[model samples]
Target chain A: MDLRPLKVSEVNNYIKRLLLSDMVLSNISVEGEISNFKHHYSGHMYFNLKDEKGKIKAVMFKGDNEKINFKLDEGMKIVATGYISVYEREGEYQLYVKDIRSSGIGELYRAFEELKNKLEQEGLFSQDKKKQIPFMPRKIGVVTSSTGAAIRDIITIIKRRFPPCNILIYPTLVQGINAPEEICRGLEYLDSRDDIDLIITGRGGGSIEELFAFNDEKLARTISKLKTPIISAVGHETDFTIADFVADLRAPTPSAAAELAVPDVMYLLKELDNKYDELKSIINKKIKAYKLELENLDTKLNLYSPLNQLKDKKIEIDNFLRDLTYVMEKKLNEKKAEILELKGKLELLNPNIAIDKGYGIIIDNRGKLVKSIDSVKLGDEIGIILRDGKVLSRVENIDEGEKIDEFNL
Target chain B: MNLTYEEAILELEKILDELESDDCTLKESIEKFKRGVILYNHCKDLISKAEGEIKILLEDEENTKEETFSMEV
Candidate 1:
């Protein structure tokens, strides 16, 4: 077969046109981890997206890159949708991405989650430590740019709903490089104000890099120390900042933070009117019921007086006294006869009669009355018992020791 | 007349909570019931309004897409 040699630029342009026209290649989704990411001055992003098997070059033009909600970092997993084309000058194929979004946890996000979980486990996010937002805030301090749309939106919504609420603006930078320190200072300023009932700190929607100030650990810790409730409103509804987790309450937007900081004045006024009417009716009913109770008591007062009860008690006492006197007099006569009988029995048992008949007792040293010579041992002390006298004696000899046996023979 | 469904729903919730609580007396309960009926009517009105609003937004989005495609062609 005969063939003609083709130039590199011609072949590349043909491939580029072919790739652009291929619908499958024009709108394709690729999943890989990003590496060697570079952002050019023109705002175009260049990066290599790789899987375990291979890697591909990718480029996101400025317009497409602006739509990314989060920062792109090396080693961050992403899913990119783009058209495939050959770069004519480099003669290399690359993906020209229209959209690139996070497919899994980026490195910074993973670090953020890790630190958040650690702090939460250490009890930093405990509900008991969270201060309650006041139901009716008198003065709300806001920490954001004085000229930014966030403060403007917050003030508008707050004033519209609750006209009486006062606002104190700390006016800190809500974005850019110096935003974190400015936010911290703003929080401190608001916290020092004794009149401030609560603080709402946040910014409007932005890229993750622009919202980085709210994700600072120092700012989050500062929010935790505020005596006034801190309501975090950072980024858009899809964005979450560290301040959101550490704050007492997290609102989806700056305007929402204002709404949460103070109750709707119209709703509150309606509730107050309802309560007032209910209280008035309750008080009126109570007054009428109390008057009726007093009237009923007045009617019973005439029939049931204290003097009537005392008169009935006096008659009962008199009847009880008469019965008591009769029973006492009968008991006294019966007791006198019993006393006389007891006196006669006592006289019959008197010892003077027995003593006059001349009976006597003899006792030894142990107080036994000895009646014979054998009753006590020789050399032992003895006591003689007589009708009216007692005598103590000691034995003179043992001659009588055999006398008892002789007398028996 | 300008009431939205979300507003009516919120009002009904408040009325229901008041009636269900022990704090309200029988007379208060009756008043809340009457207010709740008014809110229910407002909610019906708002639902009809939302249906119209959604249809309008959807048509606008469709027209914008058609216009973009024609310009591209």
Candidate 2:
């Protein structure tokens, strides 16, 4: 056969076209263990997929590598999906991997576990680091898909429980490759606003892959660093994510998170009413106690009142005056009777009365009265007076003999 | 009189605590009781006046806009 010698470039181009034309070779899945894995600074990944018998080189460009949910390492068994094509410069055929996945467990799950363990050891899940959820948040920021059921449920629950709170929604993607970055941005946006009191970040129920964005380490760290308390409400009740562990509070669903973010106004009002009744009762009791004390003081004051004491003193003085008047009257009557008896004696001893009864008085000439014969001594003259007449007589012998018969006057 | 719901509730609680304490005088208790009544009424008014309105805040490079938000189910 007469054939022209093909150039090296032509040969590589032919093989490249041949592999690209084959449908089976163009889109295939190859299962092998990853070896000699090298992540280039250009965001491309180069590795070799080795089976028990053979090995093939693979290269994943930055676009495809960006979709990888887990870090690639040597010896990890995976299934790479892409076409086998020849490199023109190297003169080698390799698999241009479009996607890679772990053979048994999902790559996203592995990534979730890996990041969870790493962050747990770093104390991002520590309870003391979590902030306290505000009891009554005036404004709540919700980070999730705006059109999804998660936001709808959160808004409904929040409105029902607390109507006064303002709900601020930060629309974000919760799944796919760009989900982690978008979610981080949403959190940052809410954090930047000073008016937001609390943050509720989450999505509705989904598969592990769909929930993988919450497993991102950077997102978890952002949640841990937030000054405003965050409530993570991801997927169903059974699902848990790294965001759940790092958040200040966790709710099984978005509605539950909304319920936790605000307080029920009706219940608070009832509590205030109870407090009001208690305060009124306490004040009444205090007033009653004071009234009783005043009454007791009044009784004590009446007992020692000066008006009552003056009444007692007046009664005492009246009794003393009566006793003094009675004693003085009795003494005066006794003195009057004694004085009357003395006056009667004086009247009986009167000489005029004796003379009126025929008894005469005798006197000497010199106006001396003689009571015995020796005192007369034969006086030259003597005068005698009877009741109404006087008689003159010469000295006469006075009978000294025989005490002169007791004269009966 | 312009007290917020939170402040009113907090003040009501303080008044209740003072009234319950033995150290409070009768005149002081009465004064606090009057204040507590006013606070309770203010809180009740706040709760009754609240109309549950949902609003969405849309912020772009140039301006921020507020629109009434309702769930489309």
RMSD of 2: 15.8
Task: Tell how far residue A171 is off in model 2, in angstroms.
Answer: 0.7
Task: For candidate 2, give the DockQ.
Answer: 0.40
Tens digits of per-residue lDDT for model 1, A1-409: 8788889888999999999999899899999999999999998999999999999999999877765645789998899988899989999999999876578536558867887887788777889988888765667777887666887788778777766666767666676446777789778866886978888889999766567677777787888888888899997888998899989999999988877876665675566446445534544554566679889998788558877778888888988888888788778877888888887888777655665666445577778656667776778887655567867778776554445446532
Leading candidate by lDDT: 2
TM-score of each: 0.42, 0.57
Off by over 4 Å in 1: A1-105, A286-409, B1-73
- Could you give the TM-score of chain B for each candidate, in order? 0.59, 0.66
What interface RMSD does each of the candidate structures achieve?
14.7, 2.3
TM-score of chain A of each: 0.47, 0.53
Q: Tens-digit lDDT track for model 2 on B1-73?
A: 7877778888887787767777877777778888888888887776666665566667789776767887887
Per TM-score, the best of the predicted structures is: 2
Please give the TM-score that candidate 1 achieves against the real structure.
0.42
> In model 1, which residue pairs have backbone atoms overlapping below 3 Å?
A361-A385, A362-A369, A362-A370, A363-A368, A363-A369, A363-A370
Error of 1 at A9 (Å): 30
